[model samples]
Each structure stands twice: as structure tokens, then as C-alpha cells.
Target: MLLMPENKDQLVSVLTYHVVSGKVNAADVVKLESADTVQGEQLMIKTTDGDVMVNNAKVVMTDVEASNGVIHVIDTVLLPE
Candidate 1:
């Protein structure tokens, strides 16, 4: 099994894995099959039973607007393989 991130760089890599490089809304999110993150990885996106899943995380809340971008809340952390 892979070890958890133990350093700042590793933490940043894990954090950025959750982020998709643009302001994607919930409507657009469900339509997508996958997305690329700022950390230089591709995230697998899937919708099952009307719920959107990003990797293994479930998108709970979405479209939280910020000055720079939008935020989509997920139920779990997404880690790169």
C-alpha cells in the first residue's frame, strides 16, 4: 500500500489533486466523465444513482462562489496513485 503524505510538498500534491483547473459548476460536473487537476493528474469522474463521484469522493455541495473560482465540496479526500 502507498503511504500517506508526510511533507509539505506531498500535502500540496494531495490537496491539488482535489481541484480541477477551472470553475466548474455542479451542472457541468455531472456531465463530465473525468477532469484534470492542477497537480498534473487526471481525476476519474462518475455519476451513479444521480450522485456525482470524483474518484472515490462524493460531491456533496457545489457552486460555492469565490473571487477567483468556484468550490465544490466533497465527502472524502482524493489521493493520487
Candidate 2:
């Protein structure tokens, strides 16, 4: 999955977001209030002006399926505090 070294950080965040639950769609995500990421931090789910955000980052593209789980592309890198 590390096709590019430059993407390692973003890749890790993407991978972490996948394991919270099984493959879930955008609509499903909207119904969820929060999810605990693999990084051990909680991701807050919120919708504003019809855009969905995980914590403070906006989900740009969602529902990308993978063998292990689903991937939701976000505008910013999520780091565990």
C-alpha cells in the first residue's frame, strides 16, 4: 500500500480509518456519531452545509473499498493526540 514514500503518513491515517467498522457507506457514516480509530483516538463525525467531516477534516471522497476495509479520503491528515 506504500506505493509512494510521500504518502506514508496519509496512508496510515487512511488505514486507521478503515478498521473502526466494516465497509460503511457515506450515508452510514453520517448516521454514526463517532468512531475510534486504530490510532486510539476518537474521530468526531459532523455534517455542516452538507459536507461531512471527520474531526476537523472534510471527507473529500468516500466509500473506496479495500480488501481489509473501506477508505474515505479526507482533506487533512489525522494524527492521534
Against the true structure, whose TM-score is highest? 1
What stretches of model 2 exceed 4 Å from their correct place?
A: 1-19
> Which candidate number has the best lDDT?
1
Off by over 4 Å in 1: 1-6
lDDT of 2 by residue, 1-81 (tens): 565999898678766664575567887999888987675668899988889998888999988888887788889866665
Cα error of candidate 1 at position 36, Å: 0.4
Instruction: Report the poorest 10 consecutive residues by lDDT, candidate 1.
Output: 1-10
Candidate lDDT (C-alpha), each: 0.85, 0.79
